[model samples]
Every structure is written in structure tokens, then in C-alpha cells.
Target: MALGAHRIPPGKAWQDPAVVFAPSVLRLMERVTEEPHPDYVGLLSGHGASRPGRVELSARGRIFVGERRYPKGSPSPEPETFMTTAELAQKFRANSEGILAHECVEAILEALQGLEKVGDIRGLMRLL
Candidate 1:
């Protein structure tokens, strides 16, 4: 049971899904960085459910609370192109991953904000 957190209902992730919704690439990233739905409580008994993830992204990089990291890099497969050298591939992959991670963190943050503003699982139900 979640304690000391919101019981917001379900609906939007607060942020624009478009920014974070990359189904094709979603598989490549990690989960939320913080507890998911910290204030989530079941309506029937007012039992606070497990908190949602609280994702965070900083200059260091993306961070998921309980997820694995997807490392980025390129192989020296005979150095395919002028740009895709081993180092270039690694850099490119890292940049791409960073972008994706940043987006996710941003989205989760928005969702949390929404939850905070709405207040209570009852308020969240209105979202549905």
C-alpha cells in the first residue's frame, strides 16, 4: 500500500504522449525513475496503492527507478561510413538514447504534476 502520496486517478501522463510515445523505440529505454503513482489509493477502501514512478533526467542522463540501462554504441563492422566510425556509432547511439530518455523523464514529470494539481484518486477518476 502506498503511503504519503497522491491517489490520483488514471488518464493522461500529464505530458504530451506524442513527445514521449515512441512505441518503436520505447523498448529501448528504461522505466520510470521514481515510485510510480506515489499517491495511488484504491477507491473502495481508500487504501493508497503503490506510488507511480518518479522519473528524472539530468545532464548526466536518464534515470529509471527500477529498470535496466540500455547502453548505446556501434560495432566496428568494417567502419561502414565516413560518419559511422566506431566512436561515431557509439556517440550517435548515446545521443539517441539520451534524447529518448530525456523525453520520458519529461513526460513522467508532467504526469506527476497533473496528479499533484488534481488531488485524490477521486479527482483522477474525472480524467476517465
Candidate 2:
């Protein structure tokens, strides 16, 4: 599925899909830096694209929480969520894995809280 100019790769595992959607998510995060409202729902929903809804945000939140509890890539227990990324992908017809990356999750949370200005896509890309 497409979100703005980015395409969500279908049927991919969570570990490998961020490359496709990170650019678009980064663009949205940059846009949010200029907005006054913390429209997390709007951002995750793709400005009403029908996928990557609130549930995706919740899932990302879980990932964030998981990362905080364990060292990065240290085989931490799976964070609980309302739905799995695979299920979300199937339901929304869009790969939900992109938003689950640790960097993407952190960037998104920072954007949602108005805590950071995501103007440096290159820096973020380097992190990814």
C-alpha cells in the first residue's frame, strides 16, 4: 500500500520493511515539526489513508517499551500489543513493519511529543 509517495512493502517481515517506509515516515515527522498539534493519530494514520491506524501506533509503542526494557537486539521478550505486525499488514493491506524499527519508533515518539525536530533525514537514514 502507498502512503503519500512511499510504498509499504507487503508480506515482508518486520525486520526488513523499514527501508521502504522510513523515508515517508521521516517526511511526515518533518512536517509534524512545523505543526502545533501533536497529531500522532494523524501521522500514523497516514493523514487518513485507512492503514497504519492507532493500532500501529500502539504496536510501535510496544516496541519502544520493549527496547527500553532490554538492550537493542538482545532477544527481549516480545512486547504485547492489540495486534501483531503481520496481522496488521494483512488487515490493512500494507506492511506495518516499517514503523516498528527502533529508530523509527523513537523518531515517531519524539515527533509525537514535539520533543525533537526530525529535519535531518540523512541522519535518520544513517541510523536505520
Candidate 3:
């Protein structure tokens, strides 16, 4: 996001869903990785290549890295911005369907709506 935000084309690399695996981007990464490093190095992984991928960047000594995490079939061009509150709730409900009853999901949603009124977090944990 930061890279795309700073690019002359504001949505060039990070925002475009297709760019996640663009050959140019991968090539650039390969070039960077091939650069001579005297000490440790870093790598990038999880750029919509798999479900529940991680988004992180870290380096060791002379290397640098970047990574990304996004669920499969998730809309792009700012996927996080595409979900509505109700849609998020629906997703939550769907994911919890087998582990939690519909009633429990509804109760949890309601409790979250007025979370400030919750007196005890244990009360909510019990539901889970």
C-alpha cells in the first residue's frame, strides 16, 4: 500500500489485483533478491498466491523483504474497503455457522454493536 500510494500512478502495484502477481513485479523482486549482500538477506511471500496469506516485511543484516496476505476470491483495489458492516457480519456469521449457532452469532453481533455497555468480557467469552 505504501509503495502504491507513493507511486506516480497511485494504484499501480499494490491497488490493482492483477498486479499482485504481475511478471514485472516478480521480475523486480528477483532482481532485488539477486543483488549482492555481504551478510544476511530477506524475502517476500504471500501476495494473494494462497488463501490466508501473510502480509509482512522483515530483513536480516543486508537484506530486505515484503509480503502480503489476502483471502481467496476477495475483491481487490482496496479489498478491505469493499466490505460493509452488514457484509462483514454476514461473513462472520457464515464462518461461525458450524461452531456457533445462529442465535449465538446474533447475540454476538448485538453485543458488539453496544460493546461499551458490556460489563464483563467474560460474558462475551462464555458465548464463544
TM-scores, one per candidate:
0.16, 0.17, 0.39
> 52 in model 2: Cα distance from truth in Å?
22
Ranking by TM-score: 3, 2, 1
Q: What tens-digit string does per-residue lDDT give for candidate 2 at 65-100?
A: 111222222333434434554454354333434546
- Span of 10 residues, lowest total lDDT, candidate 3: 37-46
The better-scoring model by lDDT among 2 and 3 is: 3
Ranking by lDDT: 3, 2, 1
Residue-level lDDT of model 3, residues 1-128, one tens digit each, is 33342342322235455665666665655543233322212321323332332333343555344433334236654466366778778767866766788899999998887899999989888887
Those runs of model 2 whose alpha carbons end farther than 4 Å from true positions after fitting are: 1-94, 98-103, 108-116
Which residue segments of model 3 deviate by more than 4 Å?
1-80
Q: Candidate 1: where are CA atoms >4 Å away?
A: 1-28, 31-34, 42-54, 61-128
Computed on alpha carbons, the lDDT of every model, listed in order, comes to 0.37, 0.41, 0.56
Residue 109, candidate 1: alpha-carbon lDDT: 40
Taking the tens digit of each residue's C-alpha lDDT, what string does model 1 give over 1-128?
A: 01111232222322436524455324424432344344344331342222223334443475434321211232222233234344543443444453456555444345544666755665334332
Local distance difference test, candidate 1: 0.37
